[model samples]
Target chain A: MRENAKDPERHARRMAAKQKIMQSRIDHARKEQGVLLVLTGPGKGKSSSGFGMLARALGHGMKVGVVQFIKGKFSTGEEAFFRDLPGVDYHVMGEGYTWDTQDRQRDVAAAEAAWEVASRMLADDRYQLVLLDELNIALRHDYLDLDRVLDDLQARPAMQHVVATGRRAPQQLIELADTVTEMKVVKHAFKDQGVKAQKGIEL
Target chain B: MRENAKDPERHARRMAAKQKIMQSRIDHARKEQGVLLVLTGPGKGKSSSGFGMLARALGHGMKVGVVQFIKGKFSTGEEAFFRDLPGVDYHVMGEGYTWDTQDRQRDVAAAEAAWEVASRMLADDRYQLVLLDELNIALRHDYLDLDRVLDDLQARPAMQHVVATGRRAPQQLIELADTVTEMKVVKHAFKDQGVKAQKGIEL
Candidate 1:
């Protein structure tokens, strides 16, 4: 043990205090309802984190609906795996990245189509979890109407969770979200070390 | 079509310019090597994000090693499902949360034991990806020597990817990592809405 380590009795007392505080907090947090989670920022893993929740939802046998708003240029490992799973309604609606598609009109059309799918899923009580992958990008580019999206999200079932992921999330969405996580980029191998996206890791 | 949409020819020209820039940047990024990823901050889904990477690694037929540093209190749905899959070596190595254990010495011992397992996997070439879950917490409480942990991580195989997940990651670890994502808390349902941790979502 380190020489400066706390005595066992002292540690016990400290932990007891912590336990009491945590227990009280846990007890106080008794409310149960669905949550709207938004993952946004200039870092990696926004969609990946959303997929993690998808996996968790699937593990619990919950019905999930996934609508890819802006990612379809390259095939992702997640789409390959989760699409085959039971209780998952997966739809890849976008043609590709905005720049790759090379057409603002086409991008708007795709975003609208994706939003239609997402709105239907949000309205359906049978789907416990709905993931709108890269919806933020579409919103960022003004490819979809922000007001309509917010109104639809507000009208979702009380017990249905919704997760929207991508960079540059709208401030309105952030304000309405029950939980919002911004993935800050501390370091990125792609930018700093000239590292290409790996098969399993990045794709 | 939206009445004010950009002309198709103009949109195509703009996209062509973007594609050229993107292609040049993509062409410049030619390095291939394993990445050290750190997921840290005061928000949810740090571990969930790590699990997503684990799933991605598995989908590519990569061998994965998981050493849970401080999350053995409850049986997680992820553990129950992923443990059954082939090519995954999963070890749950903590009595429970630090407050739950209430024993500093015991917690330190458990963390050290878990580190030993992590070190071995880091050295082994068979495991392509290794996830050290809640390791930042152990390091945060000074239960483990950060220097030794850094040295071991530095000594790992060149092609092995390691992911560390937890809040308050040491600055030294962040400096060493290839990809670092800080999950900033915009809002938490537990703190703001009195929502308790759900079974599949929080377990």
Candidate 2:
């Protein structure tokens, strides 16, 4: 271990080689455009991850629009903080989760209304980042037409980054996305420890 | 569809039932203590999700401590934004990723040093949230002793929430964690689209 630690020359050579490879890759990846990201799966942090991007966009002084598709039943901490921030257009349009509503037709109407708002934001060039929170849930429940959603997404402004987050993303949306993350459930507190969602951490 | 939309009374009844159930569950979840969360697997957003929690902690006026275990080589937007914030103790104690470093002894040494900083923060009661970014990568490579890391985590203050982010979390750590998320890579831009990590999004 001591001998390995002392070999600074070899480490320097190795790093140089890596730097060359990375630089070439970086150079090759020169295309710059807004990306569509999908966060899905049965694990936690899908929405939380979307919010992180929202925060990042805010940090960059970019205009952000958020349309919550199925999470307006309970107030979240992110809403309380980012809603009041300047250059943010935040809207919570859902009545609640689908299971809580239990009315398919009503849920469909609510989702359509939410998508109307989302479509407008996607069309508007002023917004650099548009977060369609829980849109996958709406799509999964067949509350929103997949074809119409795809068409709207395709027609969005060239520089507008869109992030759709929820569990069980549709195959077509995944195919259309530049980045798709599936948050697999390794272990959940609700399932394993019987710990319900809390304010600071889970809300 | 019109008839379903007009049935407000039925919707109200269902919502009321859900409200009652949710409220009871919320009441039942009265136990409040610090949560240890592990965000792992092979996808993006592990660190991003941890940052979201950091933001939540900040919103609650809680002190935050961040130790970047394997991301010190480059300047991330999160570090640029949060490092200067009041009540945030930010430390980037890595020589980049292990693959980049390519020196096991040096990587082990760096991991130990980073863990030292993490251990101090975990022991301090002043920090309500401590984020150990990319610590799982270090653990996966066996750069730091798992038993020691678990011991330090176990000794943290009762109300100090800890979040460790990276891929391939150890099974023992998962067993001990209150919440664990595995971010599966459905589609990565680097792999599929050849999109490099962007400034505001990936960094």
**Clash totals, every prediction:** 0, 0
**DockQ of candidate 1 relative to the true structure:** 0.54
Report the lDDT of model 2 for residue B22. 72
DockQ of each: 0.54, 0.36
lDDT of 2 by residue, B59-168 (tens): 66779999999874333667776788787999997677755777767778988999999999999999989999988877876778899999999999988889999888
User: Model 1, range B50-161, lDDT digits (tens) per residue?
Assistant: 8778877876778999988877423375676677678889998866887788888898899899999999999999999999988998898888999999999999998899
Clashing pairs in 1: none
Candidate 2 chain A weakest lDDT stretch, 10 residues? A1-10
For candidate 2, list the clashing residue pairs, or say none: none
Which predicted model would earn the best lDDT? 1
Query: In candidate 1, which residue ranges exceed 4 Å CA deviation?
Result: A1-4, A72-75, B1-10, B72-75
Candidates in order: C-alpha RMSD to true structure: 2.6, 3.9
Model 2, position B181: C-alpha lDDT score = 88
- Per-candidate TM-score against the hidden true structure: 0.93, 0.85
